[model samples]
Target: MDLQQMRYVVAVAETRNFTRAAERCFVVQSSLSHRIAGLERELGVRLFARSSRRVDLTDAGAAFLVGARECLAAADRAVADAAAATGVVRGRLAVGVIVTTAAVDVPELLQRYRARHPDVHVVLRPGHSAELAAAIRNGDLDIAFLGLPESERPSGVESVVLDHDKHVLVVQAEHRLAGASQVALREITEETFVDFAHGSPGRAQSDEAFAAAGLVREVAYEAGAGELMTRLIARGLGVALLPSAFIRPLAADNPELALVPVVDGPRRIEWLAWSRFNPSPATRAMLDVLGVVRHA
Candidate 1:
C-alpha cells in the first residue's frame, strides 16, 4: 500500500531473512514484520511463509515482488528527476571497483570527479568483478568498474570498455624462459603455474588460452591478489599468467620477476557498467566525466 511497505517486501524477498532485511532497511525486526503483516492484511493475502530458520515468499508474494521492485525503482527515479530539475547534481553515488591494477588511474579519476562535483557524495566499494556486477544489477551500486570477459558480460546493464588488458607470462628472472621476449601457451604447458583463484576473469582467461592450445597446465598455487601471486613467483614457486598492467610495475621494481608477452592470450576488457534502468543525475554526471555515453 505504501512505498516503505513495498521496500520491506522486496528486501525480505531478496534476503530471505527478516532480521537481515530489517538490518538492510535500517529498521527493527519487529517493526518490519509488523508492517509487512499489516500489508498482508490490507491485501488479504499472505505474502510470506515465515519460520524461525528461513523466510520464504508465498506464490502471491513472488508475483507481487516484481511489481514492488518496479514501483520502488520508479519512485526513486521520480525523486532523482525532481532533484535534477532543480539543476543540482548533488546526491549519494555508490561506486564499486574491483581490486586490480587499473589502466585508467581510478584514484585520479575520483579526485577529478570530486573536484568537479563538490556537492556530490561518493562512496566507494571494493570487490571482485562478478560481485560488483551483481551489486550493480541488484541496484545496490550506481556504477562499477569490472574486468569482464567480452562474451560473458551480464545482461540488462549498459557498459563502456575502459581498457583492454592483456595477459603476460611472468616468471623468476632465473627461470629458463625469462630472457624470452614472447612465449606461447604451448611453451609453458608442462611448467608449474601460479594462477588467480578459480572463477576470476584472469584465471578464466588463462584457462581458456591453454584449452585453446590443447594443453593442460599444472597449477601449483592459486592467489587472489596479483601482488601475492607475484610474490609467489618471485620466490620461484611457479610461473604465472597475469595482467600486463599488474605485473609491469612490479617487474620494474623487482628485478627477480620477468614479464614476457603471451603471443596468444585472451585480452581481458575492463568495463564501466551501470544499470540500464533510469540512472540518477550523479550517475549521469560521472559517466560524462569519464567520457562514456550510454546507448539507448
Candidate 2:
C-alpha cells in the first residue's frame, strides 16, 4: 500500500527469511512480520508461507513481488526526480558500456563528467553491447555505449555516433607474418584465426569486416572477452582481430604480441544510446557533457 510496505515485501521475497529480511530492512523481526501481516490483510491474500525454519512465497505472493518491486523502484525514481527539480542535477545515473571501451580512456571521460556534475552519482556497468542494449531497454541503464548497427536501432531509443574504432589483427611476435606493416584481410583467411564469440559486439564487427573482404577465416579459437582474446594470442593459440584500443595496453606491456593493422577490416562506429522518452536531468547532463547530443 505504501513505499515502506513495498520495500518490506521486496526484501522478504529476496531474502526468504523474516529475520534476515528484517535485518536487511533495518527493522526488528516482529515489526517486519507485522508489516507483512498488514500488507496481506490489505491485499486479502497471504504474501508468504512462514514457518519456524524457513519461508516461501505463495503463488499470489510471487506475482505481487514483481509489482511491489516496480512500485518501490518507481518511488525511488520519484524521489530522485524531486531532488533534480531544484535546478541542480543530483541523482543516480546508471551507465552501461562495453568492456572494450574501458580500455580506451572511458575513466577519463567519467572523471570529466563527474567533475562537472559532482552531485550526480554515475554507476558504470560493463558488459557486451547486446547486454547493454537490453539493460537500457529495461530501464536498468540510463545510457549506454554500444557498437549498434546503424540499421538496427531499437524503437523509442535515440543514438549518436561517438567515434570510429578501427579493428586490427593481433598475433604473437614470433609468428611469420607479425613483421608485416599491414596485412590484408585475405592474407589471414587461410591462417588460423582467434575469433570473438558469436553475438558479441566485437564479433559482429569482425564478421562484417571479413564479409566485406570476402574472406572466410578458419576460427582456431573463440574467446569471451577481449582480455581473454589477448591472453590466448599471447600464449600463441592463434591470431584475433579486435579494436585497436583493446591492444594499446597489451602492446605496451607485452613485447611478444604484435597488433598488426587490418588493411580491409570494417571500422566499428561507437554510439551513445538512450531512451527518447522523458529523461532525468542527471541523464541529460551526462549526454551533454559526453558530446552525444547533437545541435538541431
Candidate 3:
C-alpha cells in the first residue's frame, strides 16, 4: 500500500531472497518480511511462494510486479523532473554495451556526463550485440552501444549509427597465411577457425560473409568472449576474423599473432540505441550528452 512496501516487494522479487533483499534495501530482514506480509494481506494476493532454500514469485506476483515497476518508474521520474527544473539531473542511468564496442569513447563520454550531472548514478555492463539491443527495447537499460552487421539494426529502438568497420583475419605467426598482406575469404575457408558462438551477431558477420560467397568454414573452437577468442588465435588453436580495432592492439602486444586484412571480409556497424517509448529523465540527459559527444 506504500512506496516503501513496493520497494521491499521489488527487491525481494529481484534477489529472490528475503535476507539479501533486506541487505540491498538497508533494512533488517525481520522488518522487510513483516512489511511484505502486510503488503500481501492488503493486496489479497500471495506474492511469493517461500521455502527454506528458495523463493519464487507466484503467478499473481508476476502480474503485480508489472504494474509495480511502472509505478516505481513514474515516481522516480517525478522526482527527477523536479530536480531537472532546478537544473539538476538525479536518477539512475544503466548503460549496456557490446563486449567489443569500437566506436565512440565510452569512458570519456561517461566522464563528461558525470562532470555535467554529478547527481546521476551511472552503471555500465557488457553484453553481446543482440542482448544489449534487447535490454534497450525492454526498458531494462537506459541506452546501449551495439555492433551489428551493416545490413541490420536493432528493432523497436531509436538508434544512431556511430561508425562502420571491417574485419581482419587473425592468425598465429606459425600459420601459413600469417605473412600475407591480405587474403580473400575463399582462401581461408579450409583453415580451422575460432569463432564466436553460432548465430551471435559477432559470429553472424563472418558467417554471412562465407554464406554469401557460397563457402563453408570449419570452426574448431567457439569462444564465448572476445578475449578468449583472441587468446585462442594467438595460441594457434585456430584463426579468427575479428573487428580491426579490437584485434589490432592485441596483435601488437603478441608478436606471435598476426592480423591480416580480409580483403573480402564482412563489415560491422556500431550503433547507439535507446528506448523509443517513454524514456526516463536520466536517459534523456545521457542522450543529450551523447549528442554533444557525437558532434565533438
Candidate 1 per-residue lDDT, tens place, 183-268, comes to 88888888998887788776787788787788899998988777888889999999998778767877899999998898887578
Candidate of highest TM-score: 3
Taking the tens digit of each residue's C-alpha lDDT, what string does model 2 give over 84-203?
777667878999878677323678888888888898888989887888877887788888877643334444467776666677788998998888899888888877778667777667
TM-score of each prediction: 0.74, 0.88, 0.94
Candidate whose lDDT is highest: 3
Q: In model 1, which runs have C-alpha deviations exceeding 4 angstroms? A: 10-31, 50-56, 90-98, 118-142, 146-159, 179-182, 197-201, 211-215, 220-224, 250-256, 263-266, 275-279, 293-296
Q: Which residues of candidate 2, in runs, are more than 4 Å off? A: 50-56, 102-104, 149-155, 294-296
- Root-mean-square deviation of every model: 4.1, 2.6, 2.3
- lDDT of every model, 2 decimals: 0.85, 0.79, 0.88
Candidate 3, residue 218: lDDT: 97
Model 3, global lDDT: 0.88
Model 2 CA lDDT for position 83: 75
Tens digits of per-residue lDDT for model 3 on 1-296?
A: 98899899899999999999999999999999999999999989899999999999999999989899999988988999899888889999999978778787789999999999999999998888888888888788889998898789889888888888999998988888988989999999989999988889999999999999999999989887878988887788899999998778777888888889988899999988888887777888888887724221
Backbone clash count for every predicted candidate, in the order shown: 0, 0, 0
C-alpha lDDT of residue 51 in model 1: 87
Clashing residue pairs, candidate 3? none
- Of the two candidates 1 and 3, the one with more favorable TM-score, higher being better, is 3
